[model samples]
Target: MRAAGAQRGRVKRARLADVDPSLIRPALAGLVPYEPGKPVEEVQRELGLERVVKLASNEGPYGPFPAALEAIERATLELNRYPDGGAYRLGQALAERYGVRFEEITVCAGADAIIGYLSLATLGPGDEAVTGWPSFPSYVLDPLKVGGTPVRVPLERGRFDLEAILAAVTPRTKLVFIAAPNNPTGTTNTRAELDAYFAAVPPHVLTVLDQAYFEYVDDPDYPDGIAEYAKAGRRVLVLRTFSKIFGLAGLRVGYGVGSEEVVTAIAKVRRAFDVASVGQEAALASLGDHGEIERRRIANREAMALLTQTIRGAGLDFAGPAVGNFLFVEVGDDAETMHGALLRKGVVVRPLGPFGAPDALRITAGTPEEIDFLSKTLSDVVPAFR
Candidate 1:
C-alpha cells in the first residue's frame, strides 16, 4: 500500500512538472504579490525576542469592543452551522446607518475582497481601471487579476491629484478607485475636489471611493463618500471596513454601499459566505457602538500627534496632516537599514519599498506604553540614520 502511494505521488509530481506554462493566465505576467506587514509571532521567532510591538498594519492598538466580544462568544455556539452567505443582518445594519436600501449593500470578507469582486464583475480584456499610485496596492493588483489594464496617476504632494485622475480616464476606463485618506500618505481629497470629479468624470466609469479610515478623519471638509456619491445618485461604490478603527481586523469584515444594480453585479462574482458568522456578529455589534468609535478616534488622534512630534524632534520629515492612523516618515536613503534597526529593537513598522517609496516607513498608533517604547527607540535609532 505504501509503495502504491509513493508511485501515485511520483506520477502526480511528474504530471505537474509536465503541465504547460501557457495554461497560466497571461494577465498574471510581471505581477508581484502584495506584501503585508510581518506578523508578531514571526518577528518574535526570528529575533528570539520575548516582547515585540507591531505598528505595521495600521491596525488599532485596542481589541474589539466589549459588546463585540460578547457577540463573538455568542456566535461560537452556532459554529456548527454555516454563516449567512449574503451576510444579511450585517448588510441591513450598514444599510440603515448609511441611509441606503438593504439591496444596495454588498458585504464581503474585507475591503480587499470587495475590490476583487468589483474588478471581476466590471473589468475584462481591453478594459481599464484608473487610480492614484501609492494609494492602495490592491487597486493596481485587482484589475490586473481580471485581465484589465491599470492607469496609475501619480500623487501630487502626497495626495490624490483629482484633476490628473480625471484626465487619465479614457473611454475604456470602467472603474476609478479613489482612496480617501490614502494609505501610506494618509492625505485626503476635499469635498470640492470630489464634487468636481463627480461632475466631470465620464459616464462609463464606475467610481470606487475607498474610505477604510474615514472614522479617524476630523476634517469637516473631508467628504463622506456615501453622502457625496452613493446617496446623492452618482455612479459610485463606497468601500469601508471594520478592520480599521473598530478593532476587528482578525474577523475580516467590510462592506460596500452602491446602487442596487452595482451591488447585484458584485454579488454574482464574490465568494459564498465571504464573511464568517462571527465576523458578521462582531461587525454588527461594533457598528452600533458610536461612543466607542469616538473614543478610539480621539485616542488615535493623540497617538498620531505624539508620533509626529517625535519625528519632528528627531529632525526628520513626514508627509501629512495625516488623517489616518499612521504617519509616512521619510527615513532618508538609509530607510532599509533603519527598518532593520527598528525590527531588532522589537518595533515593527511597514517599509514602503513595495509602495514605491523606498525612503519612507509607515508607523501606526499604539497604546501609551507602546508609543513610549517606540518614541524612545526612534530617538535612539533615528539620529544614526539621519
Candidate 2:
C-alpha cells in the first residue's frame, strides 16, 4: 500500500511538471485564491440544516425584479445566438441614464472582469495601483496580475483616509481604486472628501470608482459618483453593477462609465461576447422598473436598521455610516472562531481576514427572519469566543 501511494504521488508531481510553467503567473502562484461565500445547497448539505441564511457577498435580500425575470425568460429562447459583443443596447441605456455618450460606457461579465481588463489595459511591470487596504481584494490582485505593484493605504477609523491615499501617490502610480462605501467595512467617502482627494491626485493617474452598492445608499453626504466626477471629464471610471441592487448576481452584468478615450482603451482588452444576451436583456429590463428597485431599496434599509439594532443590543461594535447593503461588525478578537461557529449553525457570514480586517465579518442585510436567525446565532456563539 505504501509503495502504491508513493508511486501515485510521483505520477501526480510528474503530470504537474509536464504542464506549461509560463502559463501560471509568478505573482498569482504566491497569492491566495479568492474564497467565495458558501453556496446555499453546499452549506445545507454540510450542516444538515433545513435553513441556511447566507449574509455573505452582500447580494440583494430580495431576488431579481419581476421585469428582469420576464426579460430573462424571453431571452432564454435566443440562447442559441451569440450575445451582442459590443453590448450596444445596454451601453446606450446606461449612457442615456448617466447622461454620457454611448461611446463612454463599457459593459462586462461583471465589475470584477472590468477591473481585471482595466488593470491589464493600463498597468505594466513598473506601474503602481494605489487603493485602501481592507477594500476589495480585486483592486490589488488585478494590478498584480499584470506585473504592477499595489500600494494599499490603510483605512483611518474604518473609513478610507483620503489624505493618506493622496500622499501615497507618486510618479509610478498608474491607477487608483476608490471603493466608495468600501467593501468589508461598508464605509463611504463623502463628496467633499472626494473633491479634496481628486484635487491632490495628478492628471496622469486614473481613478476607478467602484459603486456596486450605490442604490442602497441613503446618505445625502454620499457622493453622486458619476455626476460628481465622471461627468466633469476627470480621469475616472465609474463602475456600477446589476449584481447587487438588481439582484442579478447570477447573471454577471456590470458596466463602467468614463471618458470615451478611457472606455475605448479598456474595450481593447475585453473578450469577445463579454456579457451574455440574457444578462443584457435582464439588466436593460431592470433599468425600466424604477419602482420595483425603489421597493427593494426600502426593504434593505429596514433590514439594515433591524440588524444594526440587534448588533447594538448585543453590545457588539460595528462600523456604521455605511451607504451599502451590508454592515461590518467588529466581533472582538475571535472573529474566525465566531465565523466557524455560525457556519456550523448554517448561518454564513463573510470573514474579513482577506481584506486585512482581522476582527470583523461582513453581514449582508437580509430579510427579517434571516436577520433574526443571524442575531440568535451571534448571541449564542459570541460569548463562547469571548
Clashes of each: 0, 0
Q: Write the per-residue lDDT of candidate 1 for residues 94-191, one digit (tens) a residue.
A: 88888889999999999999999999999999899999978788898899998999998999999999999999998899999999989888888899
Q: Write the per-residue lDDT of candidate 2 for residues 57-135, one digit (tens) a residue.
A: 9999777889888999999999999999999999999999989899999999999999999999999897999999888
Q: What is the lDDT, from 0 to 100, of the residue 130 in candidate 1? A: 94
How close to the true structure is residue 86 of candidate 2, measured as C-alpha lDDT?
97
TM-score per prediction, in order, is 0.94, 0.94
So what's the TM-score on candidate 1? 0.94
User: If candidate 2 were superposed on the true structure by all CA atoms, what would the RMSD be?
Assistant: 3.4
Lowest-lDDT window of 10 residues in candidate 2?
8-17
